[model samples]
Target: MAIKYGRPIELREISRRDGATASPALDLTVRPRRNRKAEWARRMVRENVLTTDDLIWPLFLIDGNGKREQIASMPGVDRLSVDQAVREAERAMKLTIPCIALFPYTDPSLRDEEGTEATNPDNLVCRTVRAIKKEFPDLGILCDVALDPFTSHGHDGLIADGKILNDETVAVLVRQALVQAEAGCDIIAPSDMMDGRVAAIREGLDRTGLLDVQIMAYAAKYASAFYGPFRDAIGSAKTLTGDKRTYQMDSANSDEALREVELDISEGADMVMVKPGMPYLDVVRRVKDTFAMPTFAYQVSGEYAMIAAAAGNGWLDGDRAMMESLLAFKRAGADGVLSYFAPKAAEQLKAQG
Candidate 1:
């Protein structure tokens, strides 16, 4: 029931029931509902707005030509080959999406304990970067600089004696960042959660004549339970050895997230990201308000799968949920969001305009 619009009808009914010519109204000076009485008024007073400029679409890549495989876990999302990925980039540009993030699904045959496949010059990521940049040179391409997609153990860092080696992993991450930036990537996002890696990657790029490349550190990545479907989409669900609690931040600690973000910023990161977006929005707000950097949030694969599954079951409207979820990030003070629903949301925004 529209509160403001229904109040007048209720007053008329009361006046007739009391046998009086006029209704006795309760005096009210400040009615909050006045601004929400109509859609135009609501738009005029909206505090935050979601638009195509605030969206970053994540695209998954696979090895092959002219192939497209739908991820069972992520309903509408697909694992496209280089050609199909280029076509998708074209679509993103047409929709006015400012950027597209790339995540590769490395095959098992190329997997190794050392994650050596990550540094291969002709790997799936490097090749896809070349293919997309060739046709759509103006489109911004962001590449994830993590080895979990290329590792046999499905861990982001190198492991030894049942423990993650931080400094050793940073060394490899530097090489990975270099290859992606060299292949026409505009942003190198390190999601490995390694200490001091952001500084090392920045120095590595500066030394290699790649000073123009930007770094978006996954500063506050937490080891939450919401990443299961993401592992499945990348084929890491079956290969993961154990939990990554030792490296990823604990969900119970918000102050620790601030320390992590502070360290990354001091280490020379151009931007910062909060992963598993909605659940960690407090951290997003804190990071944005505190550092004022280009703060971003990622709507993980598990979050997408849950909403998609519920929508498929006819429980709620998928479009509204997607838009509301993304808007929540914006209202929480995120500069942009990396979402699986980017293309759909962009289309919706265009229609509304």
Candidate 2:
């Protein structure tokens, strides 16, 4: 039967019916909200969990004394001096954070067309690594092997006639890796997207008797605008006049990330990373499923600033959002996350435990 315009279409037939009509029935059998109604139930059924050990704090090191220059774009992040950086590493150790990633804010005067400063033994990053390891011997130090921080043109490699030289850049990266390894870095992460860099760096580390150092390749870094805050933090924003789309992958592609991961894994990378994590969880999942290697996600600076800004404006609950974001990484199969919120998130998790 059907009803329309305040009248039933089978009204006449219904009126002519002699037998008793059965009543309509409505069934409501399952209630999924029952489990959600209780906090304990929610906790028990939570599939993905984020912990302090899953966090790797990224810190910026600059040459100075007792100075912590605040990066305005990244609200809570600052460029710390060597001593200040050591103190932060010590605090991270106290909070049970397993590692700290280092990016140097090289002096502009030290920048070169070839990024030669990157291979220097006394560069900002190399010095910072040695100092931190000396102060906190047990804490893991992950060094970025890219030359952008030390390059004046803001490209990640040596430039010739306005084009990035891939092989030449790999040669420089090999030396850079050796220098960082010599400085006692536990991991040499190559964020540069140069061809054959992973294999080159592996051989270089081996030749230098640093076979124990790990290689975490940034396998799938996209040309994302989300990295503006990071560039600003490293003082490279002003220098990067053009885009890096020539080297970085397009954000529209997902399957290409898998290919990139395969290439890096085959090139002797012990681990692979997917940058701008939230925007590419599919990429992360595909890489993890394909390689089954140690995959890390970088929760870039802009993501952190967005949450902090929203929370500061009373538009959202900061703590809940923070936990949810980190848990999302774990849910996406990230072995760990490099986040600016590592300290705060670790504190919250410790308190919850």
Candidate 3:
């Protein structure tokens, strides 16, 4: 029988050469693919959606005027000077990105074993925060409250006899949080993964009367190899003396992530984040489901580098991959994602409308 164009056809039994009738249809009631048959239908039934509001741009800060230094490992990302950072902040605001996370590339001369520059109000990160907040009062700024960028040894906390001192580091992290809050940072993100830091920083913030500032804890950060490009971006790759397995979570542990998140939440973390997002999406899903808090994921530099490398080689559709990866974060119950592709993804979303 000939088929007609653009019309549903009724199924009928067909005769076989052996005199047995072949049924044209089986007992099927549900068709999941039917909703995905068209672009509009697929969009209408999409379980997760990514938008500018769901993005937090992770920007690197450097010390100079009108400077934009490209990070070789992470293509399309730059370490912007305070002046240049302000421009980037304005652009982010225009793109409707709600916040920007700042990681500074501190000069080697300023870095010390104690990471003293971390508490300096005039340091690169603090200055960048001040500049951005001055130019755009409404633009949210998230500052990294860790010592790695300012430490000569490149550890996130104070080191003594090859050990990362927990209480000593928490004291310094409290000071660092105060500096960032004083500089008008909207979020003091403790990415150090040190024990009892959230409570320490929270108490410090309260004592300083910066009561409105929020803490976005790096609750489930892993000691994964995926952080190479990020360490490069912040100029910490060369200074890092050893691995962070003692402090950061193990890649093999999922239940440990939930415990970490629970601790941070109990210690007054306003939001929580899981690092190296794509690889740890199961952890993200579990954390979100268990806590039902504002959870975020960081699409770390290595993930961005791989995509950019493949796209540069003409092996992948960069734009589509970026959007899909971000959408996957939303699918995993992330309220937002910290990504290197924030600006590009925002542009794509804007163009779609």
Who is ahead in TM-score, 1 or 2? Answer: 1
Listed in order, each prediction's TM-score against the native is 0.95, 0.91, 0.93
Q: Which pairs clash in model 2?
A: none
Worst 10 residues of 3 by lDDT: 1-10
> Best to worst by TM-score, what's the order?
1, 3, 2
Which candidate comes out best when scored by TM-score? 1
Candidates in order have lDDT scores of 0.91, 0.88, 0.92
State in Å the error of residue 51, model 1. 0.7
Worst 10 residues of 2 by lDDT: 19-28
Error of 3 at 350 (Å): 0.7
lDDT of 3 by residue, 1-353 (tens): 32323332333233344223433244457867679879999989878888899999999988889899999999889999999999999999999999999999999999999999999988988888888898899989999899999999999999999999999999999999999899999999999999999999999999989999999999999998999999998888988998999999999999999999999999999999999899999999999999999999999999999999999999999988999899999999999999999999999899988
What TM-score does candidate 3 get on C-alpha atoms?
0.93
Name the lDDT value of residue 185 in candidate 1.
93
Ten consecutive residues with minimal summed lDDT in candidate 1? 1-10
Query: How many clashes (backbone atoms < 3 Å, residues ≥3 apart in a chain or on different chains) does model 3 have?
Result: 0
- Candidate 3 whole-model C-alpha lDDT, 0 to 1: 0.92
lDDT tens readout by residue for model 1, 314-350: 9999999999999999999999999999999999999
Candidate ranking under lDDT, highest first, comes to 3, 1, 2
